[model samples]
Target: MPVDSCHFRTKPIHRNTLNPMWNEHFQFTVHFEEMCFLRFAVVENNSSQTTAQRTLPLKALKPGYRHVQLRTQHNESLEVSSLFIYSHRTEEGPAGGATASSLVRFIQVCCF
Candidate 1:
C-alpha cells in the first residue's frame, strides 16, 4: 500500500496551577502505521528542523513553521507515509506576504 495523508496538531500539555512564567515546551508525537515521512517547517512540508519545539521570541517565531519526514524501514523516500500541518504561532505571526509560496504534488491511484 502506498502512503497517504497524515494529521497534525499542537496542544499544551500543562496545568495552569503551575507558574505560567516558567518555560513551556511543545512535545510533538507523530505516529505512522506504515513508516515515517518528512516533518516540515512549512505547510507544504518544507524547511529543516528547529530547536526541537521550544519557546522563542516573538520576532523569531514571527513566521514560524515546522516540517518533518518519515523514513521507511528500508530508508526510501518513495516508501513515505506523510503528514503535515501549520498554524500561526501568535496573532501577529506574520501574514499576507504578497508573495505566496508554491506547492507541488502528484496523487497516485494504484499500480497496474
Candidate 2:
C-alpha cells in the first residue's frame, strides 16, 4: 500500500495478563503494498505511555499466522514481547475492462 503511516489502539484492555488476545481485524487500501509499513504499539492505559512497539514492511510479511517481535522505545528488543498475527493479501482482478486491480486485504492481530 502507498501509505506513509497508520496508527490505532486496541480497545478494552485485558487486565492482569501479559498476553492479550484482541482478535481484531484491520483493512487498508492502497496503490502499492511494497511501500507500506505496519506499526503496532502497546500503551499503558493509565499514563498513555507506549510500552512496546514494532514496525514491519507489508511486502516483507508472509501470508498466514506469524509472530512479530516487539521492542522498547529505545529500539532494544524486548526478549519476551511479541505479537501473534494472521495476514491475508488479496488483489481484485480487473473488472468491467478496467486496467487496474483493487488492492485490499485484511490483517488480524493479537497482542502479547
Candidate-wise lDDT, in order: 0.28, 0.71
Which candidate ranks first by TM-score, i.e. highest? Answer: 2
Q: Pairs clashing in candidate 2?
A: 1-32, 1-33
RMSD of 1: 17.8
**Tens-digit lDDT track for model 1 on 2-54?**
33244443333255522212232332222221233323221112343331222
10-109: candidate 2 lDDT, tens digit per residue: 6856665666777777765545666677788888888889898988887788888888999999889999988888777666545555444354444444
Could you tell me how far off, in angstroms, the CA of residue 81 lies in candidate 2 after the best superposition? 0.5
The number of the candidate with the highest lDDT is 2
Candidate 1 structure lDDT: 0.28
Off by over 4 Å in 2: 1-5, 96-112
Each candidate structure's TM-score, on Cα atoms with residue i matched to residue i, is 0.18, 0.78
